[model samples]
Structures are given as C-alpha cells and as structure tokens.
Target: MAVTKAKKAPTEGAPVFFIMLRNMLIGLVSTVATTLMGAAAKGDWLIMLIYLRGKDGPDKALPSFLAPSTNGTAEHSVVDEFLEGYGMKHLHLFILMGVAGSFIIYYPVGGFWHWYYYVKRRDQAHEWKCQPNKFLTKENEAHAVMMGSFNMMLGGTLSGTIACYIVNGGYSRLYFSIWDYNIAYTVLSTMFVFMLNEFTVYWSHRIMHMPVLYKKIHKWHHRYIQPTAFTASAMHPFEFLLVQCLMAAPIFIFPLYAGSYVGVLLWTYYYGMKDHSGIIGESQWPWQQDVMFHDDHHLYFHVNFGMNTKFIDMMYGTVRKKDREYSEDIFYGFGREKTETKAQ
Candidate 1:
C-alpha cells in the first residue's frame, strides 16, 4: 500500500537524535542476524554438496565430517573436504564466499528495511518519507528488485575479482594485525578510508550527472523517481562497476587494518541502502545522514549530488534550494531542463 500525504510543513516531533540511534541499532541488528544466517546456510550447502558428491562416487561411501580426505591415509577437516571435493583453491573459495555473502547480505537486509519502513510502519513513518505524495508503481518496484538482484551479483563478482587481484599483486596496503602500527593508527586509517570513500562517491556521482554521461549511464538509476532500498542498485552495469572500483580504490591507495577495512566497506554499504531508501527525516546527529538528501536528488534531479554527507554538496553549491520550486531547474546545472522527465 502506498503511503500518501498532503503537502504541508513537515511536523517535527521526536528528537532526530533518538530516531537516528534507533535506526542505527535496527540496521546493525539486521546485518548481524543476516550474516549469521548466511554463514550457516553456506555451511549446510557445502556439506550437502560434499555428501552428494560422495554418493555419486564408485564406492558410495559417505564423506566424513571430521576428516574427508579422498586418500584413505590422509586426514583433513570438513573445510578441506569441501575444498578438495570442489577442486577449489583457498583463493577461489574466498572469491566464491565473498560473492555469495554479498548477495545474501544485500537482499535480506534491503527486504527487511522495506518491510519495516514501508509496510510495518507505513502510516507511522508517512511524515518521514521524502516525497509523501509520490509512490512507485508495482511494476516499477518489481523492475527495481529484479535489476537490483542482477546488479548485486555482477557487482559482487567484480568486487571479489578486484580484491583478489589486489591481494595477489601485492598492491594493497592491507595489514592483518591491528597492532601493525597501533590501535590509534588503525582507527585513523579507517577514518581516512571512510572519508576517501565519501570523496570518491561525490565526485564520481557528480561527474556521472554530466549531460552525456547521465543520459547514457546514470539515467538508468534515476528512473526510479521515488526510490526504495532496492533501487540503490538498479543502476547500469558500468555504474555498478564504478561503485565496486570506488570501494576497492581506498585499499590500494593507503595503509588500512584488514578488520577496519571491512568495517569501512560495511559502513559505506549500510549508508548507501539507507540513502536510497525513501524514509526521510532531518539528521540531528552531526555524523548521522538523512535519506532526504539523496531522495531529493532522485526527485529534483541535478542537485544534492553527495551521498552519506551533505557537506560536499554544500561546498560545491549543488544542494537543492529551499527557496526554489521543486522542478528540474530548482538548482542549475548545464542541460538541467533538457534532462528527460522522470519515468512514471
């Protein structure tokens, strides 16, 4: 059901600080639960595959859970059994796991966010939607979901390949021990990558908005005028590749603790889903991001080009203007009015 509301000044009630904290906790809990579920499911799938493979063998002997080496004299753990059974190297297994885990984490978390904000609390959250009067048609939602799934699979594989290449070529400054430098340095490095991600997203996204590029590439994503969590990835393949590159770029550029590097990537992803989500409220905490910022970009087009942070847009004078009417020309850019009207 679509949550519709009349045009009026947004009534502020609950403190945005409390709201931000609550949303953060919900997102974190959802991610942890989904991650555990994905891990367990993956383990079971491996076990099943190993068992079935043994069943198809000449002797039909069940594979041992503890030691399932093909040679009778050799000893190996279940992990080794699966790796041996599939004839996969450790690096190959890592890439497969990375791709599968990305898909598992993305859809489930995005679905939960949609259900929570758009279904479970639609009326309660009506005032918070960036465009309360606007809604995506059922067909649009379905298209977004299908395209998002495809993009995730493609993007995940590309990211895994990039990660493997970086590791294999010894190009990345990734360190395993947190104390390789010091705890303070680890924290500082994470912050550095985090900001670098923001910078890259801002510039890359802004550049994509150029008339020629937007029409050819970025326009696929902007088709969803009223975006949901799923719409976060309903972008062109080239754009998806760019996103993968953006996530991997920081690792090659500077020193980063392994654990914190993963954390930074998660931070960027969590915020990406939230930003595209139509759920909207002004950010109260200095570090908290508001959905309205990016949602407005989809709605107003050619403005509010920054993600996760509004400071970049503010610095560059691209933020949507409050004094202007909501239209393509609300904030000026070359060929702003010439941009196609949003898809219905």
Candidate 2:
C-alpha cells in the first residue's frame, strides 16, 4: 500500500456562478420575509382594531386609533388618521414590490463588481474550485439567508414605519418618483446622508470591535473574515437597529423638495451592500477612482474606517495610503508598527 499526500484547495478566480446563485437565493428570501412581515404586521393591527371596536362600540372607540380619515375631515387623534389612511391592501403590495424592485436593481449593478472585477482580478493565480468550499457550506448559506432577511426586514420596517408617520403629515411627495431627476438635489442629499451616517457607522463599528461588545453584538458579522454575498447582512439585531437608525436619521431630519428622498435611501442601501461585498476594484471612468475603501476596511480592518469618503481619514492621517500596504492577517497593535508590518 502506498501513502498519498493530500492536495491543497484552489484559492483563485471568481466564484462567479456560486456567488450569483447565493445572491439570488439571499435576495429571494429577503423579499419574501419583507413582504410577509409587512403584511402580517398590518393584518395583526387590523385584527386588533376590529377587536377593540367590538368591545367598545364604534362611536365609543378611540378615534385616534383608527386609520386615516377619508371624509376630508381632520381627525383630532393621530391613531384615527393613521388607521383611516393605512390602506393595508395597496400599501402592503406596494411595499413588497418596492423592496423587491430595490434588491433586483441594486444587486446587479453594484453587486456584480465583486465577481466581474475584484474576484476575477484578485484570484487570477489561484486554482478554481467548482463546488462550495468549507466556508461556503450549507450552514453558511442558511446563516446568510437569515442574516439578509433580517437586515432588510428590520431596516425597511423601521424606516418605512417612520416614513409613514412623517408622510401622513402631507409629506408623501418625498417618496422617489421617475420624473424627478434633479442632479443637484440628488448629489446634495446623498452627500449629506453619507457624511452623517459615516459617523454613526464608524462609532457603532468601533464599539463592535471592543472586547465586550464583540463577544455579543458584532461577533456574528465578523464570523466571515473572508465575506461572501450573504455575509453582507449577517449582523445581530441590535447592531442592525443601531446602524439602520443612524442611516435613517438624516433622511428623517432633512425635508426634500421632490421625491429624491427615496433615491437617497436606495442609494444608501446600494452602497451599504457594496461596502460589505468584499470587492476591491477600480471604477471604469477616470473620475470614478477605485474606492474600495470601505470593503477594504472589512477585509483588512483599521485601514479604511471611513464609510463613503476618505476626506476625514485623510485629514486625520488615518487613511491607509495605498503605497503603505497591509495584511489581512496579524493583529499587530495600532499605529506605526501595525501599519508598517501590515504594509510589508
């Protein structure tokens, strides 16, 4: 009998087919969860209202708790108007469609970068494995599905509910529309949200790195050191809420002239997913410099802390200059020694 040596797994090339497949599955489950959650919540609310009405005659029931008043009459109570205007039939469908449309459009455009550019370029020298690796096992797939669904559902539900309250006050015009294409408005709003949310993410992310917090709130996300499409949303519920609130705060505070608000929100989601996509590729055009800054931070922590831009990092000398390369491994303390060794 002859003894044989074990062969090492291939480490190169884009997991194109599998990556896309995973993305599709994650997107599908996310869409379903979002739709079901919204519908169920609305249904439960309706049921509760009906029960209350039965217990206390319609006239005696609290008017504030009802839906939006359609009689061109302003109700004194907030609940009444909320109930009257809340048409579960169309609203639920609209929400489901909107969320589904968002993932469909966003993932293809922004999500494709990882497979097309980053993975293809980075893994050129490594061997290609046809089947899923240990990291991409069935368990990982399930985890990713749960993470994606929870992230989207939680973020969308919270933001949409808040928007419901604000929009009901005659601010429905803020929702994004096809006809409204104001470049200036879009740019300004995007920048504002990016700037504000960056702080929120940075602080929350930093906290997650802390020993105590990392053990609980943030550990699940970091479980995927080399993240895949599904790893994007694999975070704890508390982490999700904190980050989503930070992301949504600007939108709530700022009043928009047109429906560009929706565009801004969508843009945030698009970029947020891309940041976690584990891609590091250059954009096509000259002005669109290769800013894999955020994803790089996730891959090689402490280098790219800033979310959307490098301005603040650069200003504070925290920006990891490309010339000063860093390693994916090694927890060499912070500053010069860490940076220098990693760069080497």
Candidate 3:
C-alpha cells in the first residue's frame, strides 16, 4: 500500500521478519496444494491425471508429472511406458509443471487483466497506464506471447530439474502432513530464494540496458512503450537466460526445499507478469514496488531498472523523477530515452 517517488524512500517498510513469515505461509499453502495435485494412491480413480509414482524421499517432493490422459499402446500411452522404462518419470513432472506454469499462469492472467482494465474499464485509462497510446501491435503481441511462453516453459523445466536433484538429493520432498515439514525451514528457504531472485533480476535488468547490449539484445523487449499483460515476459531468450535463470541460483548455495522453490517461481511468474502489464494503480504488495515502478521502467527506460524493489535503482541514481530528463549515458550508455521525443 505504498507508492514510491524517485530516490526519496518510503517512511518505513514492513519488518523483514514479517516478510519472511508471509513467505512461509505462502510456502505452506502452495506446498500442500501442489502435494495433493501431484499425489496418487493406486486406484484413486484420479490415476489418469498422475499415472507415474513419486520419486523423492517418503517425506519429500519431486518435479513429477501427470500421466498421459490417453488410452492407447497396449492400453497405456507412449508417455506412460517411456518414462517408466527410462526411469526418468520425473522428467514428466518437470515438463508438466513447466507447461502448466507457462500456459495456465502466464498466458491467461495477464491477458484477462489487460482486457478487464483497459477495454472494459477504459475510463480508468489515465489511472492505469503510465504511457497511454503507446500500445503493442498484433505482431509485437504475438512475438511476446510466443517467446515469453517458450521461455517460461524452458526456464521452469531446467530450473525445476536442477533444484529437484540438489534439494531432494535426487529424491522427492513431500510429507504426509503439514506438521511433518518444518515451518522454519520452509520460511527461511523461501525468503532466501525470493531475495536471491530479486538480486538477480535487478542486476540483469540494468546490464541489459547498457548501450551496446540494448540495441543488440534488449531493444526488442522495449518495443512496446506501453506494454500489456502479454508483454510481461517478452524478452530475448538471451535476456531471459541472464535474468530468469538466477531463480535457480539459490539452490546451488542454499538448501532450498523442492516445494519452496516452486512456490517462489510461481510468484515470480505471476507477479512479474503484472509488473510488466503497464497498469499503474494500487496493488496488494505496493511496498514491493510492483506496478508504477516497472511501468516507469518501460515508459522512461533510463530509470527504475530494478525489479521488485527500488533500493538498488535508487542507489544507482536511476529512479525516475516526474520531470526527469534523459540526455546522456555514463558507464555503458544506460541512458537512452527522450532526448528528443521518448515514449509518450
């Protein structure tokens, strides 16, 4: 419930412990739901959704997937036996999670919001858009959707597998009940993952805006001055690799739980989409510098380069002022806005 203004800061932020507590609560909810969704007990009749068995330790989790929803090939689908015979059934889970995260979460949510606020509630135009009339074309929309969808799936699959192997020691991380898993572990691990992810995106975003890199790599992402939901994840695969891949960095150092990792990325995908939707208004985690901050990044590229928090951008003196001017570049030519006429 806070809106930041330039380098000046919020009077105060919710305590760090409270943020960690909230992450723990989110982990608890998401873990239980994903655990059940991936759960299968022979003859539950829902076996069709999850034909394969679990892989992690008895009280652990895995990136497993739902069995094929088809009935063929000796009464079993090709996918059914392929995973079992290869002993890589967990691959199915990773692929399924990736596809679901990409299509289900990333696709429809942002699209719906854009239509909801922009089309249906057009009267709130000024309230919503930081840079009105600078819409993405059908071509840009299609490119963004296709590229973003593919990257979301790819990033999820790779990161899930890596995290699964490391966190579970090549096993699952599911427990029969919530009491079995330690809230301290889940909460601390989730907070680590969240903070690490923020650090990754903040630096990656600033690096992309460098002059030599901008025209070569990040320019395509800046095509839509007034981006919508579909444009949330739109970026060059190289850029996605630079920024999104860091979500897995915590796993290499910290012992992040498998379920906790998934929860963190789910937030990243969902919230990051909203961040790019170009909608400027009150949000649930306004203190996180959600909408206006990111919209300002797209509208006035010279400022607000940090993601999820403005601390880094403010420190770098890149936070945008209402009447900020974009005239020159310093280190790597990061400043490239309206010296003449920028995004309006």
Candidate 4:
C-alpha cells in the first residue's frame, strides 16, 4: 500500500515579516528626511562656516568663554562651552535618534513577543481572521506612512527645540543626570503627565470618532483596524496636533527640573510607542505587563481605552467581553435551536 502524505498548515510568519519590514522602511525614510530638515533649520550652515573660517572673521571666531576665558568671570569653561555648542548643533539629531530608538527597542522584543503569542498564533489557527474591511491596501498604507511620519516629525521637532532652549538657558543642571535628580519627584511628575494626557487623549479621540469628525479626521486611523506600527502615528493634521498638544501641555504647565524633564520626555515617547504596538504580553517580570495595556485597547477597541491604566474602562464597563454567543450564531444560524428541535 502507498503511504499517504499530510499537507502542511499555512504559516502566518511571512505576512507578519512583510508587515514589519515595510513599516520599518517607511519609518527610516521619514526619520532621515525629518533629520535633514531639522538640521537645515537650526543654522547648521552657519556653524559649518564658522568651523571652516578658522578665526578670520567675527562669524568664524569662537566665543571668548569657549576660548579659555582668561578673566574667568563665571563663564563656561572650554569643555562646557564645547558641550553647549555641540548640543545645540545636534539637538535635532538626538531627537530623531530618541524616537527611532524607542521603535527599535520596543518592536524586536516587546512587539515580537506579542505578535508571536497572540496575533500570529490566532492567525495560524484561523481563530482571529482580520475583518476584510480592516485590511490596509497599498494606497492606504502609503497615506498612513505619510500622515504618521509628518506628525512624528512635527511633534518631535516642537518638543525637542523647546526642551533644548529650556536646558541651555541656565537650566542645564536640571536635565543633565537622572541619578543626581530627585528620582521620587521625577517619577511622580512623570506619572502625573501620563494621567493628564490620558484624559485629554480619551476626550479628543472620542470627539474624533463622531460622524462629522470621523469622516474628516479619525477615519484615516480606523482604516487600519488591524494596525501596524506605522498606523500608530497616522492621523489627520488637526487630530495629530491635538494629541501632541495633550502630550505636551503637562510638560509646559508643571515643568520639571531640567534632568527630570528630560526623563519625563523620554518616558513619554517610549510609552507612546508601546501603546500603539499590536503586541500584548507580560514579561517574566511583573512590572513589564503594565506596558501593553494601552496597545491592547487599540487592537481590540471596545475596551482598554485608558492610557495609563484600565481603571476608567473597567469602571465604565467598556471592557470588551468575548462574544462567544455571536461566534456560535455565526457558525450556526440564529434560529438553529428551534429548527433543530422541530427536526428531532
């Protein structure tokens, strides 16, 4: 007798790989363009000219304090002056790096885990089919990339420039070192920022979901019901600005000392990226689980609306209940029970 062969199950790994690769490419291109634009706006040409001229003209000359400060009248030392100048020249570069870094660190580790454990597994088992309506086409994917990239550049530039100015203007000590700063106070301040911004986001997001606004603004985002990383930042300009403002307002209103402020900004960006990721799983460590709560909401929208915690969603009963009944109805017609009894 001939032996029978078993067919292999189709794998979901390829689709996931392509999705991540495409999004990462888009992000890289966007970051490069934004960095170039930022560099041009910050008088980098002038800095280059000064470096080339070698003390021949006023524009070419370095500041006196940077030149050893013979009088030493509390002016910046040579090291300090160099650091100050370098910081100014490359501020935008650092901002771009910071944003990119967040994505890099979050995806391969946190995102991979979530995709493997939840999304990919579901896809393979055919238990979680992406609604046809939710699939992103090539055109929509391009739109999402453009929208998300532009918004990120705008937000990053605005916040980075403002923070740089604050730090350079005699507040350098505040933002220089996390260890030297009041850690407890910084943590508290950071948490406060998260809470305030969450409320702002909730209301703003809700408003955008309304019919009139949804068609004009929020629909672009909802277009990606099965969102990729690029989908995180994709939004209408107005909506993008609104969210950025909500994230920025607390920083401006209740300013942290410089070092603490830097910490807060970094933490905020990391959280923003994490919240948008599609992955959902806890790490070996307990605290790690808290990271994916917001992202979970975005993946399954009826629940997990709160940014920092599930408090609001739970209290309001917005938590998503698994629709076992709906699934059964889909598999077996709604009146199956009555029909089955009559047949019997």
Candidate 5:
C-alpha cells in the first residue's frame, strides 16, 4: 500500500514517564503557590514596600564607598563593584527580613503560647507549670513583651547588617547549591554547626553567669524568674548582639548550606520561646533537655547552663542536683553542697 496504516489510537492515557513528569510539575507548582500565599499571609511581602531606588532617581548623595555602582572604580575591586551593584540593592529587604521576619515568627508563636497557657488555659496548665506558684504579673508581662521586642528589633537590625556585610564581602562559606558538596556532607556540616553552637552557647552562658557579667549584662534577663514565652528575648541589647554574633560566627567557620542555616535559626527561635514558656514538658528526643531544665535555671540561678543538650551539663557537673545546692564554685569543682530542697 502507498500509505502506511494510520497509527492505532492509544488505549492507555500516556507513558508512565510523562505521567510522572506531569505529576511532579503539578506538585512543584502547587508547592510554590502555597508558599507564596503563606508568605503573603504572614506579611513577608513587606519586603516589597521599600527599595534602594527612589521614585525620583537612585539616591546619589550617598558616599561613593557606600553607594551602589554598576561600574568598577579605580579604588574599588571587582568584588566591591558586584556587591555594590547587586547586593546593596537588596539591603533594605535584608534588614526587613531580619527585623520583620523575626517578629513575624516570634510574635505569633510566643503570643499563641502565652494566650493558651497564660491567659486562656491558666487553670488547666497551672499543674503543668514548672513554677506553679510563680508567674509574671500582668504589668511585668507587658514589660517583658516590650523589652523583648526592643531587643529583637535591635538584634535583628544588627544581624541584618552583619549578614549584609559578610555575605556581600564573601566572608562566609554559606552555599545555596546542595550539590556543591553532597547531601551527606551537607547534613554532617549542619550537625557540626549545631554541636559547635551548643558548646559556644553553654560556655558563653556560663560565663555570663559569672559575678561581674551577671550583674551587668545577664541579670536583665533573669528578672523574669518565672519567664513566659514573651520573655524569651527580653535581654540587654548587648547580650542580644552577642547572641547574634555567636549565630553568625559558625557560617564563617564552616561550609553551611543555606537551608540548614535557616532551619537552625527557625528551631532556635521556636525552642527559645518554648523553653521560656514555663510549661513542663518532656524532651522531644533523648539527647535534648526538657524545658524544665531551663525553667530551673531561671528559678535557681547558676546551674543548668546547657542550652539544647544535657551532655555539657552532665560532663561539667553543672546539672542541677536536687539533693544539693549549686554554687558558682561548682564550675571549679568545689561548690555543690547538700540541701533539703525537695526535687519538684
């Protein structure tokens, strides 16, 4: 026959590969749409409210060193030019991401817990409260929220500034592409960062409890002896800045995937509020300490300095011994003495 027979109509819908590809694309699009909607709902789109470019024109009054430049100048390197031209354009958004994004996360989370446990279910949660007899007064609660907000804003701005500086300066080993190394290495690096952070946090916190640092810097936070969720960030601005520095230090010290870095931050934020909430709860993992561990720190200062893990406290004997009174000298192996305060 001159012409080939017409191809038989396919009974099955499509090839399995094509079907799978279509499903994957649909899932991806749905995920993106969902994320965008969530961001919009959370007011992350506030990032779009400000820009370096003004309605009149680019702000030219800024000093040459500070101003964004598309062309390299004789005094500045190509790196500087690229940073100025590209990174500087997003400085406002970076700052907002730190300030607004932190508040967006912190307020909602802390507020919800505060409302549920402190206000709405006070009677129900009273038994589970680590300090059942103790609670921040309403005035004190307001003050705590105010101070926390102030410190968070200042700390967030400082964080944003440092982030802009380091990222634009190319000082950190933070990478976006997971394949730059491998998934295993990325995970290993994240674990390493968390462990290192725990070490630094435990040591720094213990140091802050030292006589001089405690009176001058750390006492501000301890004022909330029975801290609420809102009390999490209620610290001196200096202490807040120091924490930001600790947070930023790790990226410089290791090759951190951006996703891992963000995840660490989110966990830190949530746990910080949770632990300060005065709610008694079991540890999520065997390695992690319960919120009561920190509640005890606030209840009885100078012990339980470990943040996320009990390993350091166990090793250093900083763990609260119910049968003994902990003294500052415990750090030197000489302070704990027998006491009659029954374990809660």
Candidate 6:
C-alpha cells in the first residue's frame, strides 16, 4: 500500500542545539573513520604488491602520513623499503589501491550511518526522517545497499587511476599535504574547490533530470525516494560517474595538496549524508537551507537538484522551496508523524 502523511507529533528530549551537535558528531566520526579505513586499505594493498616483488619497504621519500619524523627528516619503513617504493613509483599500484580502498571505506560507512539513524534511534526515527511513510522495504533496502556499494568501488577505481596519472606526471605540487602549503593556499583552495563542485554538480544534476537520462540512468537512485544516509552514495554507475567527473574536474586546473584533497573527500561524504538525512533541524545560518532541498527532489521528483548549497541553484532559478508542514514523509503506518517544522 502507498504510504500517506501521518499526524504531526511533538519533538522531545534535547534542544535543537544538542540534537544538531549529536547528529553532527555521528556524521563527522563516520566520515573520518571511513577515510582512515581507506588509507589503511591503500597502504595494505601497496604492501602486498611490494611483497610479491620480494621487496619489504618503501624506496623513496614518503607522503606526510608515512614520513612523520622527530628530527624534521622524513621517516620511512626502514625495514620495508622495497615494499613501499615500487608501488609509489608505479601507476597501476595506486589504481589498484584506490579501487580496494573505496570499497573498504564507503560500504561500511553507509551501513553504519543507516543503522545509527534509522534503527538505533527508533523513538526519534520518524521525527528525524525527512520523508515520512517512505521507508525502504527489505528488498529495496538490499538493492540500495548493493548499488551503493558498487558505486563506492567504482569511485575508488576512478579516483585511484587519476591519482596515479597525476603523480606519475611529476607534479609534486599536486601531492602536497596541509602543512606543505601555507594556510592561505589551503583555505583559498578549499573554497575554490567547493565553488567548482557546486557549479558542476548543479548543472550535471539538473541535466540528468531530463526525461531520457532520468529514465535510463538516474532512476536507480530515485528508488530510495525517501533517501537515507546510505542512499547518498547509492546510484546507477552512470550517475556516479557523472557526479564524480564533476567532482574530479577541478584537478585539471588546480594542484591540490593531499590534505586539501582529503578534506574535499571528507566534506563530500559529510554533506552528502547530511542532505540525505531525513531529520529537520535549526537553520543556524541564513545560507544553509533545510534538508528539504534534496529531500523534495526525492519526494516530489521534479526540483532541487542542487547539493547542500544554493548559490548556483539560486542563480539558475532551479531551487524548489518545500512546503512548510509537509517537508517530511510518513515513517510508520500509524496515523501520526513527528514534525520539526520551523518557520520558513
């Protein structure tokens, strides 16, 4: 049976500030954990490859994460030089690591976020859910996870291939760390990357909504019309490619430091999950729109293709303001729902 809206219920427990804090921590920890896992997996794969070649340690200067030393000199795997250096010098190794790393990181991160919000917080689940009465049935949930997991793998492969190519081309500046560059460059580059991403995402997403593309490629994502944190990365391969292309587009123009690149990756994961989180919260900032932006896209299917930000959407006139009382969908079969409706 099609689910319908339930009666609005009162918000309980913590104040808006506390709820936001708790939710933000969950997201932050999840993203950082995923990134760390990816790094560990990448290192492991490189180690295996080196061991296969009868090498045990890196043969060259290492990145910041691996080169940390006490006396201002790069410290490295003194006993495992052959193991680390060969892969660092080879493009294929990076690509291999990237593919493995992506899967290792995203799948669990998505699942954990889903369980934390949807199952663990059962009492506040509906209140937080953006789309009421729109939970994925078991079959659909499985499909979403499967597709999302595949997309994460694909993203890893593509990103890894790109990293290999860039590093091999002798662009050392492209492989910098947060401390390698001055604060001004890091801050400015971060902002620029954000702007570039918004511009590309806004246009690519809007174009995909065209009927022909939507029917063939984007439909898989819309299956989770009421999106969960897991659904953020869940999408048709073509759609993931399209989005990742835009995301990686800036690399052609900018030589991003390693820390900056990691920062972008983390921010992408964070915002993507937050936007898909069904919960309503205090705006806090004038520029920050409620979840309704993307939530409406899933619920109504026609507007709000923008990401978390509205700069480009505002300029292009594609933003769709969600109805005040009807922002989220029904969570359970019961006739009542919890509303966090704030004055628009």
The best candidate in terms of TM-score: 5
Clashes of each: 0, 11, 12, 4, 0, 16
TM-score leaderboard ranking:
5, 1, 6, 3, 2, 4
Pairs that collide in candidate 4 are 174-258, 174-259, 175-258, 175-259
lDDT per residue (tens digit) for residues 1-344 in model 3? 89977663432476888878888997676444323222110001111122122333211333223333334446345554664454443455554554564455434445555677778876767766766656667788788778766666656565445433432334333332334568897787678678777767777777777778887888778876777766655677787666644654554564555456655655555456556667665555644676877876766665677666677776776777654455324333244344434554
Kindly indicate the candidate among 1 and 3 with the higher TM-score.
1
- Which structure is stronger by lDDT: 2 or 4? 2
The candidate that wins on lDDT is: 5
Cα TM-score of candidate 5:
0.70
Model 3: how far is 339 from its true place, Å?
11
Candidate 3 is scored at a TM of 0.65
RMSD of each: 10.6, 12.6, 11.6, 13.1, 13.6, 12.1
- lDDT at residue 185 of model 2 (Cα atoms): 68
By summed lDDT, the worst window of 10 consecutive residues in model 3 runs over 39-48
Alpha-carbon TM-score of each model against the true structure: 0.69, 0.54, 0.65, 0.51, 0.70, 0.66
Worst 10 residues of 6 by lDDT: 328-337
Whole-model alpha-carbon lDDT for candidate 2: 0.48
Question: Model 2, residue 192: what's the lDDT?
Answer: 64
Native-to-model Cα distance after best TM-score fit, residue 103 in candidate 5, in Å: 3.1
- Runs off by more than 4 Å, candidate 1: 1-92, 120-125, 163-170, 282-284, 325-344
Residue-level lDDT tens digits of model 1 in 1-344: 99897665443466888878888997678656544333222121222222233223312222243223456433334544554454432334434645576566566666676787788777776567888777888899999988876776675456544443443333567666676798888888888888888888888998888778888898899889999877877888889877766777766777877677666655555566667778775675586558788887898788877777888777887777665445543334322322243432
> How well does model 6 score by local distance difference test?
0.58
Clash pairs, candidate 5, are none
Ten contiguous residues minimizing lDDT sum, candidate 2: 41-50
Model 2 lDDT per residue over 53-140, tens place: 4223233222443323445344334444455366221233223433453355334543454355445654442332211232355676
